[model samples]
Target chain A: MSDPIFTAENVKQHYLIRQGMFADPIVLRAVDGASFVLNRGRTLAVVGESGCGKSTLARMVTMIEDPTEGRMTIDGSEILPGAASRDAVLRSRVQIVFQDPYGSLNPRQTIGKTLMEPLLINRKDVPAQERERRAREMLDLVGLRPEYFDRYPHMFSGGQRQRIAVARALMLDPEVLVLDEPVSALDLSIQSQILNLLVDLQDRLGLAYLFISHDLSVVRHVANEVMVMYLGKPVEQGPKDAVFAAPRHPYTKALMSATPTADPSRRQERIKLSGELPSPMAVPPGCPFHPRCWRASDRCRKDMPTLEGDAHRFACFNPIEA
Target chain B: MTEITETPATATGPAHPSPLREFWQYFSDNRGAVAGLVVFAAFFLVAVFAPLIAPYPPHEQFRDHLLQPPFWQPGGTLQFPLGTDPLGRDMLSRLIFGARYSFFIGMVVVSIASFFGVVIGVIAGFAPSWLDTLIMRLMDIVLSFPSLLLALVLVAVLGPSLMNAMIAIAVVLQPHFVRLTRAAVLSERPKDYVTAAKVAGAKPGRLMFVTVLPNCLAPIIVQAALSFSSAILDAAALGFLGMGAQPPTPEWGTMLAESREFILRAWWVVTFPGLCILFAVLAINLMGDGLRDALDPKLKRS
Candidate 1:
């Protein structure tokens, strides 16, 4: 296979939690170790519950948050941590679609002004008039009318605001779009429309997506491969078909079983996992998911599992098939 | 997610006028602002046409007519509608000219303080950690002293005069504006528009002015209106204490201070000028209230 458009190697982020004035600070490993790669024209979905550090990993890949250890590279250049270089590279080649569509755009700015923001930032040798024309085209591409250029953010509906956000992201024509729960905030009906838009945009632009979300259904539709995270660590990953049809990791199986399918006639035998996800401050002794893993052996509690296998990696030594 | 920007709910509700028309709409909707405008206009007129309106030249003392009462008083003359002070100057004429002095002081002081404060505060707030820390620390050092006390010291050092008083007050007032502006810019700096501006590769200066400052204007404006009253009060207080405008200048507070000893013999001397101070401050506060209400986002929601 050709070189991946973006690749992360053993990315980790540790946050320092201060306890007392002069006391020693405790470190929470938010993103223990996450590794993933996205091809030129495909989406890689990182699926996890809240506090699972998927969002942190997304920030790391987008270079918003610097990793404690490991490196993330886009094309061939290694991205550095500090504000100046990270912001420059992130702004031009990669853009993030924040969670809240309403909040992502500045309230005071007009929609046209909002869409033109990234284009103005990167400049990219595009002529001013040509930039404006391209911005107008992007609005059309996102299914918005040309007239919205003068309106403020409050004037747009939630879904429409999200569309503006997506259009703003594409304005730079970035190679990678990091979507952090892009449609989770919208209404159920609106979610499908945004998903369809994303799919269509990916196909047309030949873009790569680092799709971060907790919703399995949306991921199944848009993602080529999926990585399941627990307590800031990836437990399972593989081609969407292999992972969904025959989930190797117990945590992955538990997550998929809980997702409600569209077909009412087909009843899934849901596998209920016991206990909440352990806090990042006090993750379980061995495997991060061991406390809630039914298939976890005594060794799973004593020693953590490591990702093994090719194409379809399962971190668990005693996976479901075992 | 695809946000449909073309046909927003608010976009179709009603056609909005151009920005100028929008400003007019805002002005019309706010009745207190209209009333404030009227009062300000009348005051401006009084200041401009002081000679035409006052019956006598301000310093042309009438030795025979010392301590003359107002026209409504028992021993009053129609020639002096408001009355005359112990110095035999027409209170009406002095008040008119005094309007010019007081209004000039307020505007000049506020403008100077606001301009410098806004620039410093925005720069401090938008800059990185070390710079922000350094600027804010300097502001804190200035803020450690009471503004009135600081202004008094500056006036004493600079030599007491109208221009010196204005400079003194502006010097003292600058720090407050800097703090207010810095806070306002800090709150607005994190907003997505600023982020967008950065993404657009806007220079730091352009982003601070074009993107950040406009959003922060509401609070700064409200603070300015409120500060106008304080500036007036401060200038008057300094004048009353003989540290501001010298004798014969007829500022309201100084007039009150001078006439307080003769208040029983001539009530109009102290009462009229006192009333002027009270009413002017009250009107400005009410105007500030109206402006705050109009600019508030919470009110817009309902």
Candidate 2:
């Protein structure tokens, strides 16, 4: 395989809960030892329920946040913690599209002003007229009218606002787009429009996506690969077809069963896990998913499972297929 | 629209309108703002043209007209329609002349206090560290003192004069502006756009001004309006206590103070100046309320 556009190795993000000045801090492992790779022109969708540290992972990948213990690289440059200069280089190469389109764009600013911000910041060498030309080109590429350059964010609908956001991100001609639930905030129909737009843009621009979301169905439509997470840990990851068709991890199975399908005639057997997700602050010993895992054995509880497979990987010793 | 990928023409600033056209658009949409602005302009006119219009010098005493009522009064003269004070100075002339001093104090005090307060607040809020601790604690110490009492102490120490009163009131009022600005900046600091600006590689200075400060303007503006009226009231209060503009100066508060002895015998002396104070404060408060409503983005949508 060719060099991946981005790679995250054993990423860990621990949030400290300070009780008092003198007291010892309790560390919550929000993202624990998660790993992934994104190749050029391919998308890797990280899916999990809320609080699974999926968004944290996206922040890390985009360099908006730094992992407590891990190494993340874009192309060949390693991202350093608190190194603003290094981060800017990483930021120019990769951009993020936020969830709320209404809030993602500044209300006081016109679309033209908002889009020009990134280009002006990154490409100061480009002449003013050349910059305007590039901004208009970006707007057109995102399927917006050139006249909308003067209109404020309030004039646009949810989908159109998202389109503006996408256009703004594209101003720097970034290679990687870190979308944190980009389509989840829109209506079902509008979600498809945005998804299709993203796919079309990807094909045209040869972009890679680190798509973070909680919806597996949405991921299935756009993701080339899917990584399932449970309580800040990656339980399973594989090609989109292989993972969705035959999920090995029990949590993944439970999540898939919970998703509502459109076909009313088809009856799918449901798998329900017992109890709520345990707090990351007090994550249990050995296998973290044992409390709800149906196939939890003595060995599963005593020892942790590591990612062990060929191209596909699962951290579950008692995976269903196995 | 043509799918103009990689085109160079579209990235520049939008078409600029002439200054006259831009002003017309801004003012037309802001009629209420215009009305408040006009009332303030008239006040400015009164301040500027006081010397030209006053029939006599503000402090020049006419011994023959002592205790004479206003022209509209039963025994009032046409030359002094607003009548004379106990010192026999023209009430109308003195009030007109008082405009220059009052406005000077109001603007200078507010400007000084606002400048120092805004700088302190923005810096404290943006830079969260030992500096924040030092600044916030200093603000808290200042806030612990009652503003009027602090001004009174300051005026006593500085020796009472119009300029001294202004400096004292400004020092007393500085903490409130700092509190307002810090609150505004603190909340705006976490907004996603500021985060976006950071992600765009904006430096600390650019991010503070371009992203954070603009968003914080609405609240700061409202605070400034509220502060102006309160500052005016505090200045009048200081004058009433004889620690402000002093006797024969015809400042509203000093007028009230000097006329209180004759209030029963010549009620117009106190009533008109009190009315002026009342109208000015009410008008300022009404405009402030209007600004608070207009500046709200949620209210704008409704």
In order, what is each prediction's RMSD in angstroms? 3.2, 4.0
Q: Write candidate 1's Cα lDDT for A1-322 as tens digits.
A: 4348888889999999999879889899999988888887799999999999987887777665679998888886677776534365554777778788866777767888777766666675777888889889998998987877777777678899899999998888788998989999999878888999999999899899999999999999899999999889999988899999999898898898999988999998999989887789998888988888887789989998899989999899788873
In model 2, where do residues sit more than 4 Å from their true spots? Answer: A1-3, A85-87, B1-36
Tens-place lDDT per residue, model 2, A84-145, is 44445557888889888877887767788899898777777888888888889988888877
Tens digit of per-residue lDDT, candidate 2, span B135-214: 98998987899889989999999998878998998888888778888888888776666767777778788777776776
TM-score of chain A of each: 0.95, 0.96
What is the fraction of true interface contacts found in candidate 2? 0.32
Best by TM-score: 2
Residue A163 error, candidate 2, Å: 1.5
Candidate 1 residue spans exceeding 4 A from truth: A1-3, A83-90, A124-128, B1-7, B11-14, B48-57, B123-146, B185-209, B296-302
Clashing pairs in 2: A131-B11, A132-B9, A132-B10, A132-B11, A132-B12, A133-B8, A133-B9, A133-B10, A133-B11
